[model samples]
Target: MSQKKPSKCKKKQTDEISLSKKRNTRAGNMGIGYETAADFAKRGANVIIACRNKDRAEAACEKIKKETHNQDIHYKLVDLSSFASVRKLAEEINQTEDHLDILVNNAGVYNVGNQLTEDGQQLLIQTNHYSPFLLTNLLLDLMKKSKSRIVNVSSLAGMAAKMDLEKLNKYNNFFTDYALSKLCNIMFTIELASRLKGTSVTTYSVHPGTVKTEIIRDSGLVAIVSRSIIRTLFKNATEGAQTSIYCAVENDLEPFSGEHFEDCHMVERYKSAQDVWIAKSVWAKSENVVQLR
Candidate 1:
């Protein structure tokens, strides 16, 4: 279950007055996204939680705000599966926020079936990768207003995946599509960083371990067993959020832009993740599909 609005965080730390400004941020409000927002909120960042469910997102926002004592936390309805919804949220943020300091593409899905979105994109790929792909591009202008950081939440499932648009549609199975989506996130980070170089913006991808979240709650027996195992064998959202928080705020990491991080440190990734050609291809295809300018 998504954490109940946490009790006022007994562990919440305070910052100097100078550090207490309303920083613009937008992230998913589930799993590591919740902890990630709490971390930012504890530090006085203005956080916007985006998700498909407005009521849940709002409840999450309230809980986070109370716990972190950061009333600036709010929720916006966003359906990642729909390009229109993603674009609308991006446009709203860009117009309303003078500067976006942190953008965490941390929301994802893990369903056990194959289906297409109303937009006709594969479900998992659209939700996990393409939605963020399009959302990030639309928000780039506002992010540029600050020395900003964008964190794309990825996973180990992507280890060996490559972007072959011709074969992309053929990957209709559950695990394969999810894996490819994660890989696409990594490549998006790589290519987006290259594109944003010297522009005071940086992007990074994070492999939050098999977190015990509702991500797999609906995928049937395997997911139930996997969730149980994840609870036993892997990190919770708080622990999983660590690396994402590190990448978004660690001052020293400015040097490692575009890198993949795990356990709060940068590490070597699947060599296939370094395929610039694949990254470019993914970027081009994403642009075309999203019809970016």
Candidate 2:
């Protein structure tokens, strides 16, 4: 007997179903994290909102679910300031999820004064840089399995910051530390994209604009005054989340892999952010900081 041929329409439907099984994760609770999660949920994707506080995480998850009418949302506790906590969170995620379709490193801290994580790394650097690096490395296998996309929420501040790799951990000023951390984000994206060259996992860094987020929450009167003044010019968290969402789900970004994006458009970045030598140095030092090697 002659064998029946496969239907092209059936194959197309199967492909669509597999592509739509996108599992998304974002760090941070309020601000762009909440909005990003909601945006993904609205598109029929399962999301994981990883935050430092479980209660807030749960609340954000509920709020996102309610707003999007998508029930596939979950929350997990992750404290980027502590290496142990980051490891625990990554371990738990890897154990339960067979694949991680999208990861957005959206959480960041901008603090004044001298503060350090348990790893003896600067608080700003650890939260904004090292922790994300470690988490990405740990989840790389899962991301690879899913042929995923990684969106890192960086900033235009990175364009102006000058990084001194020698004294990177000796940070006290908020602006410099914040900018440096973001620069690191772009550099890491560049390096990771190179490393995953043959793999399906691709990475992109985003400049979410000068959005009104909780980054300055703990910075005293200065934080309040800045927020009030910038409130007039800067976009809100939902508006700021646009570029991140664009990078995460844009279907035709093959020619722009490892690029920095702003306002949902891919553009050239700063000289420092584009330096290959600097990117490699940051990658190697970050490995030592996180003991990845």
lDDT of 1 by residue, 1-293 (tens): 23232112111121221332457777767788888888888888888888888778888898997898878898888998899998898888878888988899999887746677888887778888888999999888888887889999999988956666765555567777778889989999999989998897899999977788888877578877897888789888888888787777765466677888887777776676978888999999888878887
Per-residue lDDT value at 99 in model 2: 82
Q: What is the lDDT of residue 246 in candidate 2?
A: 75
lDDT at 67, model 1: 90
Decoy 1 TM-score against native: 0.91
After the best TM-score superposition of candidate 1, give how far the Cα of residue 255 lies from its true spot, in angstroms: 1.7
Query: Which segments of model 1 are wrong by more than 4 Å?
Result: 1-21
Worst 10 residues of 1 by lDDT: 5-14
Write down the TM-score for model 2: 0.91
Clash totals for all models, in order? Answer: 0, 0
How high is each candidate's TM-score? Answer: 0.91, 0.91
